[model samples]
Target: MHGTVFPPIEPSEVISTFFFIVLLFGSFMTVVIANRFIPAVINVSFVKGYSVICLFIAIWEMISFSELVNPVLLPPASRVASMLVFLWSIGFLQSQIYATLYKLAYAFSLALASGVTLGVMISYYSNVFSFIESFATAARVIPAPAWLALSILWFGIGSASAIFIIWLGCFFPIFLNTVAGVAKVEPVQVETIKTFGGDKWDVLLDVVLPTAYHHILTGSRIGLGIGWITVVTAELASPDAGGGLGWMIMDSRVLLDITSVLCGVSAIGFLGVVTDSLLNSLEELVQTWG
Candidate 1:
């Protein structure tokens, strides 16, 4: 099957694969060594975390080389890694990454702004919460993919449609967390603010936001993760919106290009880790502010 699917691996391919392995483990060993000597080298957690990753890659290569699975279905780690390098070299990866991130940024921004705003309003106003709570609950029960057709219909198969779907996926988690955050703010603190001749705005600014910063950041992280997943789904469904990593995956699937599919999937996974790490850093920073 491998022979029929991919041309026979040439000598250059073997050499390339050999160097890819050396580079991969060389980088890992470098980091591991640095972690041993450098106190400032990425904390113990990252070092330990990456060790597990390296182990997984080693296991993956073993299984692939042993032909434990069909190579066509589960390509070798080396091939996938090389494919990633190849895609990046050709600029395809960057363009698709930009497209996906572009849609994600717009959708996530909208979700953050509107979610925080409405969440604050609902938390403060019983009437507003009463009116919207049921509707939000109902909408939240529906999966993000269910909105694909409707979004495309409303926005017409383009970036707008993709953005709307991502926003929908992101909004509820953020809104709920924000409301919870505000609700958790102590009545004593609020009352104290009022006793000090503070108005509602002063209470909101001084007591509510500061108390809710942690929760809001938590929500943003969760929403960003959901937004990332939703953006891929949106792009997969809205091919007319132009190129994106998800679109690239679906397109590759059509051509039975498993390597390309893996490349896209790997890119998404890498980006997810990077974004989550960044948000985690922000969350930690926000905790310090408290």
Candidate 2:
């Protein structure tokens, strides 16, 4: 039963696997060392939290690979690590990463710009907001996946389709949040600007925008996550059009390469962490400046 469930690993591969494990441990140690020198509360907390998650994942993988569970369905962490190296060595990994990142950047930028602009306009005009509110509410109920077919028909399978899906999924949250934030801006502030001989433009720029900045940032964070999910789903739906992490996961599943699938999942998860952290840092910087 053990032989059938857990195939033998080559000695060289085992040695290399141990080396990889040691490298991970060393990296964790390096983070701990850096944490000691870092004075910022947020930075230290983030490092510690990240380290704990990594450690938990490592332990989980170790236990899963110990023959306590079926290895066929859940390959060892070492196998996934090796698959990652192989993908990188063959130049597929970086290209796919670039493709996904490019689409994400483009779609997220469009959503942010359009959402914020339209939201501000809608908030300023009661008639416009009244006209659009029902449609926006209905659209929010429809899943992003539901638009893939129409997007494919309109954009004809490629980045265009994926971007449209991403933008569609991300836009609502940002737009709604922006409207809420603008509406919540203290009326007294606007009145004060008016009393100072400021025009509507000045009230918007000086009072409304700054007050709503935090809300906009919050919406952006939420929209970014939704955009990432939408892009991956879009890529999976149209794998032939573009190579991305999602495509890699789908291809691995087709080939029955569970290790490769796991690697792709890990890559996506890691990238999400990095992107979220960067955005959080940006939020902190903005808060300080404001």
Candidate 3:
């Protein structure tokens, strides 16, 4: 019942398991904490709103399993928690997560650089914009699995191919957004800068980019999400995929380990949500004009 329930998880990892559990609920729980602790809280009504949803989920799950829903397909939350605790102790959690994050980081960086450049070109050049609009439509429409196949063929079955597929998934939206952000730069701002003798490059640096930074950040945020989606696709088609979270989930499915699958899914989802929220917060913080 301790940490031993997971892939060699042990009792030594119980604290980490508890911390992770706290973290999983922390954002919503912050409402409860603040309402009870903070004085002069005006929006306290919304503070505990998410907690109701959480409680409802817990009750629903309880009733679901009590009504004889197969535990194998939908493992009890208690069992899932226990398994996570076990895995926490065995270093299983760290290794698998690190694997997925490593791949995603590589893909994200590539997407940021390539997407921004392509977006800037498309935004500024009418012909390029028209040409890329079609490409963006097609890329978004194409199933990721198809890209997985093409990536494998083009780059072979490893991180490089995985990174390519991830980039493909995220690239178009980011590029499009970058173009929009750049285009949204105010004409007056540009005119004013020019009247003051600012050059084109000066306008881009001081005005265009600053104005577009929020949109660019939004694109990057969305791109990060797409990168998360592509990891699953990459693992399935990847030649060298086996140890990471995606591969682990695939392996768990193959072996019919529902608890491990749940853990993997939870970790993947948790990381994505946390990262996106951080980026969103940063975007708000850095937004100067708005």
Top-lDDT candidate index: 1
Ordering by lDDT: 1, 2, 3
Higher-TM-score candidate of 1 and 2: 1
* Best candidate, TM-score: 1
Considering lDDT, which of the candidate structures 1 and 2 is the better prediction for this target?
Answer: 1
lDDT of 3 by residue, 93-202 (tens): 89888877888887788888898877777766777458767767876788555767667678866677787777777777777788889888888998999999999889
| lDDT tens digits by residue: candidate 2, 1-290 | 54453323221233244675787788788777777887564377777786887787577567665767777688767677777777787788899999999989988899999999999999899774687998999999897878998888998877888888888988998999999899888989899999989999999889889988888999999999998899888878778546799998888777767777888899999899899989899999999988
Prediction 1 global C-alpha lDDT:
0.84
Model 1 TM-score, all chains together: 0.91
Provide the lDDT at 54 for model 2: 71
What's the lDDT for residue 190 in model 3?
88
Model 1 misses residue 227 by how many Å?
Answer: 1.2
TM per candidate comes to 0.91, 0.87, 0.79
For candidate 1, lDDT tens digit of each residue in 1-290?
Answer: 54567623211333244575677689888888888888585678877888888888878877777799987788788888777777787788999999999988888989999999999998888674587888989999897878899888898877888888889999999999999899899999999999999999999899999988888888999899889888888778768865799999988888778878888999999899898898899888877877
What does the lDDT read for residue 218 in candidate 2?
Answer: 96
